[model samples]
Target: MTDLKFGGYQGDKSVHTRGGRVLAEALAKETDGALTLAFDESIVSRGHKAADLLSMTESGELDGCYFSSSYLAKRVPELGLFDQHFAVPDRRRAYVLLDGTLGYRLREEVAKATGYEVLGYWDNGLRHITSAVSIKSLADCDGLKLRTLANEDHQRVFRALGFDPQAIDVRDLPEAVKTGRVDAQENPLTNTLNFGIHETHRHILLTRHLLGVALVLFNAERLATLDPDQRAGLQRAVDHATQAQRRFAEGDDAICSTELTAQGVEITELDADTRAAFVAAAKPEVEITRQNFSAELRDLFDKELSAA
Candidate 1:
C-alpha cells in the first residue's frame, strides 16, 4: 500500500481541510485500501509559505495540498486573474462558472500555464470584508491598508477602489492586525469563524467576492504516473471531496452572518448605490482579464453558465 501525504491549512478543521479528509477516505475505499492518506503537517509550517505550496508540490517535495485562489496563484498568474472576474457578485452565477464552463476552461488554462492538472473544482463560498470600521462607499477604502492574500485579483480590486492593499500571508494576519500593519481583510465567513478573525475585526462587508474559490492544483507527475484504475480512483476521491466541501462551505457561509453577529462582528450590508460604486471600480479589471483569456473560451464559459 502506498501512503499519500496530504497537507492542508490549519483553519480549525473546517470543511476545507475536512474535504481533504473525505478525499483520503474515499481513495482508501476505492483503492481497496491500497492508498492511505495522512495529514498533520502543513506546507505553511515547512517554510514554503502559503503562496509557495503548489510550487513545492510541483517540485515533488509535497504529495498533495489544498490552496485558496490566492495561495494557488503564486505559481499560476493567469488563474489568479481569474479570481477577479470569477467574482461576479452572484453566488449562483459563480457556481455556474465553476462546475460548468468556467471550471473547465480555467482548469485547461491552469494546466497549460503551470504544467499541472486542476484535479477538481470545489466551492469555498463567498468572501466578505472584515474591517474595524464601517464601509458605506468606495471612498471609505482610502488610506485603509486592507489585508489581502498574494492574489493579484484581490490586490487589483482594492487598488481599483483606491486603497492600499497589504498583501499579507494568512498565517501572519492575526499578528499583522495586532501590530496595525493592516486595517482590514477580505475572507469568507467560514474563515472568519474558523480562523478566529471575527474576534479581532468588527465589520464584515458582504461583497460575495466570487463563489468562495475553485482550487487550481496538481502534484506534477504524480497523477501522471498512476495506472488507469488508480487514476480513476483518485479522480473519484477528489470529486467526492469536492461535493462534501461545497456542501459544508455553503452551509457555513449561510451561518456566518449570524455567527459573526453573535461573536460581535458587525455585518455591514452595502446598499445598491455603494455596491454600484464598487462594481464600477471592479468591472474594468474583469473586462481586462477577458483579453488575457481566449474569446472562444470565455464565450464558451458564458454559454455554459447561461445554460445552467
Candidate 2:
C-alpha cells in the first residue's frame, strides 16, 4: 500500500479541508486500499504559513495541497488571467470558464512551468470586503488599509480603487484584523466567518470584486512515479472531491451571511450605481494588467470569457 500526505491551511471544518477529506476517502476506495491518504487539515496549527504550502508540495514535503491560484501568479503568469478584477462576474460564469478549455490550457502551463501537476480547480468563493467601518462608495476606500493576497495584479486593482492594499498571509490575518493592523480585508463570507475576520470587522461590503479559485496540486515527480492505475484512481478522487467542494462552497455564502447577521455583523449590499462605479474605477487598472499577459493567454481568456 502507498500512503500519501495531503496538507491544507484552513480549519478542519472549512471547505478546503472538507474537500481534502473527501479526496482521501475517495482515493482509498478507488484504489481498493492500494493507496491511503493522511490529511493535515491545518498546517498553520503546526507553525507553517499558508503560503508555505506551495513550496512544501513542490519539494515533496507534502504529497499534495490545495492552494489559491493568486499565490502562483508570479511563477505562472498565465494564472494572473484569473486575477483580473470583475473579469469573472459570478460563481456560475467562473466555473464555466474554469471547467472548460481555458482551465485545461492553464493546467498544462502549470505542469510545464512548475514541479506540480494540476488535478482540479476548486471554487475559492466570490470575495467581498469586510471593514471596521462602512464602505458604500469608491470614496470610502480611499487610503483605507486593505489586506489582499500577495498578488501584484490584485494589489494593483485595489490601489486603483483607492485602497491602500497590503498583502498579509492567512495565518496572520486574524491577529492583524483584531489589532487594527489592517482597516479592511476581502474574502468570501465562508472565509471571513471561519477565520474569525467578521468578529473584528463589523461591516461586510458585498464588493464581489473577484471570484477566487484554488488549484488542487500534487508533486509532479512523485505523480510520475505512480503506476497508471494509481494515477487514474487519484484523478477520480480529485474529480469527486472537486464537485463536492463546489457544492459546499455554493451553499456556504448564505449560511455564513445568516450566521454573521446573528452575530450582529452589518451586511451591506451595494446598489447598482455603486457597483458600477467600482467597476468603472477599476477598468483602467484591469486593462493595464491584461497588457502584461502573453498575447496567447489573453486570447485564450478572451475566447473563454465570451463563451462563458
Candidate 3:
C-alpha cells in the first residue's frame, strides 16, 4: 500500500473532484484501505497544467489524472475527430462509440504513446459558443476571435467556419476573454458555469457543438506494483466513478442553462436551418479530419456515424 496522489485541474466543487472522491471511496470500500489516495485539487502540488498531467502520470510525477480529451488529442491525433464540431450527434452516441471498439483502440493507442492506463471516460457534454455578442447564425461566427484548444484540428475546424481561432489553454481562457484577446469560446454548459465563463460574457448560443469527453488515466507501471485484489478494486473504482461523473454532466445542462439565464446570460438555441448552415460550413473540415485519421480510427468513426 503506497501513498497514491491523484489530481485534476478543477476545484473541489467540480465533477472532476467528485469523481476523484468517488474513486477514493470505492478504493477504500473495495480494497479495505490497502492503498491511500491523496486527491490534489487544481494540480496544486503537481505543478503541471491539466493538459500535461498525462505526461506527468507517465513520468510517475503524478500517479493519475482526469483531463479533457481535446487536450490529449495533441498527442493522439485520432482523438481530434471527437473535437470536430457536430461530429457526435449526442451524448448517447458518444457513449456508444467510446464504450465500443473505438474506445478500446483509443485506450490502446494512448497507453502505448504515454505509458498510462486509460481507465475510463466521463462526459464533458456538448460544447456551445458564448461571446460578448449573441451568435444566432453561422455568419455570426465569422471574423470573431474565438479561443480554442491547442489541438490543430480544433483551430482548423473553427477556421473553416470563418472564425479566427486562438489556441489558448483552458486555464488562461478567463484572462483571454477579460483582456479582449478573444471574443468567444466554446465548452460544455457545466464548464462555462464551473469556470465562470458566463460572468465575463453574457451571450450564450446553445450550439450543442462538440460532446466532449474527459479521460481518467493512471500510470500503468505504478498500477503493476499493486496487489491483484488492489488492482481489481482500482478498476471497479474507476468504473463506478466514471458512471457517476457521466450522470452529473448529463444533468448539468438544464441546471446550468437556468443558472446562466438567471445570471442574465443571453442564451440562444439554434434553429434547424441555422444548425444546418453551421454543418454545411464545417462539412469540408470534417471530411478532412476523417481523412487525417488513421485507417483504424476512420473505420471506427464510419461505423459509429453510420449506425442507427
Strongest candidate by TM-score: 2
Model 3 agreement with the true structure over 248-270: per-residue lDDT tens digits: 77777889988998999999888
- The residue-level lDDT of candidate 1 at 222 comes to 77
Cα lDDT tens digits for candidate 2, 1-308: 99988999999669888888889999999999998899989899999999899999999999999999999888888888878887777788778888898889889989989999999999999999999999988999999999999988899899988999999999999999999999999999999999999888999998888889999999999998899999999999999999999999988988999999999999999999998999998899889878877898799888877888
Badly placed stretches (over 4 Å) of model 1 are 45-48, 70-81, 85-89
Candidate 1 on 8-94: residue-level lDDT in tens?
A: 765555777778778888999988987777764455565555656666667766667777765555555545544663345465666
lDDT of each: 0.72, 0.91, 0.82
TM-scores for all candidates: the values are 0.90, 0.98, 0.94
Order of candidates by lDDT, top first?
2, 3, 1
Off by over 4 Å in 2: none
Better of 1 and 2 by lDDT: 2
Candidate 1, RMSD to the unseen true structure = 2.3
Model 2, residue pairs in steric clash: none
RMSD of each: 2.3, 1.0, 1.8
Better of 1 and 2 by TM-score: 2
